[model samples]
Target: MNIKYNLVVLAAFCCTAIGSAQDIVTQEQAVKLALENNYGIKIAKQAVEVAENNTSVLNSGYLPTLTGAAGATYNLDNTEAEFSNGAPPTSLKGAESNRYNASVNLNYTIFDGLGRQYNYKSLKEQYQLSELQARETIENTVLQLFSVYYSVAQLTENLDALQETLEVSKDRLVRAQYQFDYGQNTKLGVLNAEVDINNDSINIISSYQELKNAKRDLNVVLGNALNPEFAVSTAIDFKLQFQKDDLFEKAKTHNVALLQTEKNIAISELDIKSNKSGFLPTIGLSGTYGWNKNNNNGASFVSVSTNTGLSGGLNLSWNLFDGGSTIIKVRNAKVNLETQKLQKENILIGIQRDFENAWEDFENKLKIFNIQQQNIITSQNNFERTQENFKIGQVNSIEFRQAQLNLLNAELSRNQAKYQAKLAELQLLQLSGELLNVDF
Candidate 1:
């Protein structure tokens, strides 16, 4: 009874998964889901935003700056005094000399060592690199989504096939039982049929479990609730056709990872220049405005004086000498830039090798799929003939069963080849940065 209950549950689950997953998922939906919820893409987008903000700050440095200042001063004694010898002078003493001053200063960098200019340019490049990184992230997410989507579709087909085999085996078992009771078929034949049915029943359950797991993974990838029922369309096939030479040329221009590496090298070289620029002179314009008044109670209140002045000059301060710090930094920056260039070269080599290998794999799988399609047809015919012979007593049941298994295996292989070929093609397209061009 327990086994019977388990079997019933398995059947129900299979039906549910298949019925709910019949709708084909669109490429647009996949891309939208990935952009909205994929964690990597989300992080990359945030990084780009941060870089933009940083660039804004860098740009602000080129603008004029204004600042205000206010302060109060208290002196315990009026310490300085002068007197004439021939005339009587007023002797004065104060408990405190109180003073207050307020001022506003404006500053502008009319010229610098061009450090600000270079810094801003480097920041702009950094911002572009960040944007490209985000794009790269999206590209990666799309490829991953496609992989899981097709994987689930492949499993769906396998489950359907297994369920069909299970039903056929069950019917065979029933027929064999009737024949055995009538003394036409032996009990062994009935038992063999029952065994086949049970085996298929197990396979069907396993396949359903696999499908469930696949669905769960896809849900996580889409940032959806795992329990939500989703019907994905299985009609989409992975098909990509792009000239390798053309794609390679496009990648040189458009591949974000490669472009980012090149950007790194450029920025690193800029870093060395920036560090060296520190040794150059800097120039600026500065001005100040303020108001002051002097008052003594014994005499009379003095008039307020408002002082304002503007000063502009070329200021040059070069680092005449340092304890080899500048040299060390410049050398480090140069080495780092060289290292980045070397890394970019390595990446180029790696991309070329990977593209070549993936293309070969895809082509090889295509050929295998073609071969397996023909083999499946031949195996089906042979299995059918064996079945007819078994019923007419010209061949044993064991031989018939073996032939049926052969046909089942052949069909399974053929289907696997088809999907495998598609997988290889998708992977190759991804490697060549051409997956995005594939139409749904």
Candidate 2:
């Protein structure tokens, strides 16, 4: 009965341990989680919202401003006054007075040399620029996530390969021991086998550490708790079908960075137009309605008075001269407009270069991947044959170890090539502004 109870406890502990392990996370899930939780993306979204809010007509000065105010004041004083022309003198003690006023005023810019119109257009363009910037931020974050996710996958594969190598080394050690016990192999052979096993063990430990570090990095990108343990589904295959010319065309039109620079150029051109408006006159209209009342005490001829009135007017303002500052501003705006044009051109050039480089990298990596795929099969066959020969004393321990190492190295190379190809593929998609839209 006591033994049964201990077994139940042990089983429960094992179940709990299994249940506590982290769930497997896929690349899509990682991207979704990061888009939802990443602080940078959230901030970027807020900035986009701010720009949207600023694009309103009210913010662009297209609406009239109206204000209303009312106030009253009371005064208590001892007063003495003399009229020089009439030769009269008057004095009052503890005199009390009150005044009240209320007004409503409205003002609107009737005309400003089309400055307001250009300003509104610029604001709309700025909002678009901010949206593109936000998308750029999201794209960058997704790229980082992909890089880390695949890195974890690569390391995990390498670790598995190393574990297999360690197992092979252990098998070699066992065979060497058996042969030595049977007087068919020297003690030196057994020692060498043990050393190989130890070396493989060391490598396995190092690979595990690297895998852990990579997973930690992935967790950071996922905006999860650091150092959390989780498995990632490996994505080792990628297909590229777009031509360079087509991709370049898409990049020129769809790339977020390039689109943003183009918007900037548009805004700069609008600024030049707006600054040039300074040479023209501004027209405005304003109106006000008000009531005023005053009360006087102690020896005043008029005891109380009230007045109400309505007023309206149009006003024009022209900056005829200001130390040549308007001319300077217009010149500067033109220069800035030119600078923006140059920047747009530079961005276009950069996008072309990036697309070309990423395409070449993908092509090269795909070739390497194909070669490694063949190499892995050869190495695997060689290791198996070497293992069979070693078991029958036809192959020495060193040759068996070499075969094992060759298989391990080949597998590692294959894994690296696959991941590098995927990375290049992702880079190409990113440059073409298609990564965010594609299903990973």
Candidate 3:
């Protein structure tokens, strides 16, 4: 029967608007706020932006570089000149000489064993990797949000149950007082009922402490720095069932870590090719335009000189030998590639193992939920019979308290089982890289 859920009437918790006291936050809204305000997510998204900015030909060496330069030098010195023809020697008291030159140059790599091409590809791959990393960050944050959010829900439910039982205790106290007035009960019976009332009060107070702490935790997860007073939906959707094979397949295909590792492998292979490019000839084209002027003061011949020119050239260079550094680099790149391949395998296996455990845990939690469901029914029924008997003086305070506590315990266990089962489902979806897709 659905009595377990109907008893609390909290399954529709998410839809209930916040009372006049506070705003009601739902799971989806919490995630959205965190995405907007969480610092870690902001940083991760910036990392992706940087990667995207790097994926350009200008940054990847596919385009030519243009540069401009200018410089001038001046000197003051005693000057003397001797002509090579030996006509005469001349001297001046102060001699001034200056030189100025400027140029705009362009250089382009025509080829380098296609290294630039590999570099471009690597940059694009890096961008993809960054995006995946950001996604991983987001998913983690979302999972954390759910965990803390669920804690708040569980505590809220428990607090409500405690308050409900407290009312029962109050009623019992009234009954005991009435019986005592009529001389049907002793002072001890009245004292016992009052003590139980006090104990329930203590339990409710303690639960309030716990519930407040849970709210603070939820506040942090929501990225609400102000910690404003708020309410949350206790309802979590647990109706979805998962299959083992489907999760396994989806994890292999979509798990952020696995996809990132695969990208690393591809980048590593590109690194090997990039390093091997060192052994091939590098051909490049270069051009320059320049202007220069020089003045020699107190000198014998041609005191002022000016020159300007445009120049262009093509060049090729081959690194025939480099003390085995190139070979070492190529070999290291290949080793890195192998390492990436190993990591990919390890991730694949790791996700599978996690899925195995989580799937089994999910199934077991569902079974336990069913068991708890049945147990609560029995507990509730027994409590009702005991309560009626106590009212008629057929049972004592201890027996009545036992029945009350049993029913309360059943409520707690059932709720705990339900929340735990929901957590398992979230974990399974997260492992399958479908948490955002499912929940959002």
**Highest TM-score against the true fold, candidate:** 3
Candidate 1 stretches with Cα past 4 Å from truth are: 1-5, 20-23, 57-60, 73-97, 225-227, 236-238, 251-254, 293-314, 393-395
Distance from true position, residue 8, model 2, in Å? 29
Q: Which ten residues in a row have the lowest lDDT in candidate 2?
A: 10-19
Candidate 2: RMSD over Cα atoms?
A: 5.4
For candidate 2, lDDT tens digit of each residue in 194-252?
67766665665566667767877777766674447577887655756778888878888
Q: In model 2, which regions exceed 4 Å deviation?
A: 1-22, 75-89, 225-227
TM-score of each: 0.86, 0.90, 0.91
lDDT of 1 by residue, 366-410 (tens): 899899889888988997798778767788867877887787787
lDDT of each: 0.74, 0.83, 0.83
Candidate 3 wrongly placed segments (more than 4 Å): 1-20, 84-86, 225-227, 239-242
Candidate 1 lDDT for residue 394: 87
Residue 393: error of model 3 in Å?
A: 1.3
**Range of the 10 consecutive residues with the lowest summed lDDT in candidate 1:** 295-304
lDDT of 3: 0.83
Give the candidates in order of TM-score, highest first.
3, 2, 1
Greater lDDT among 1 and 2 belongs to 2
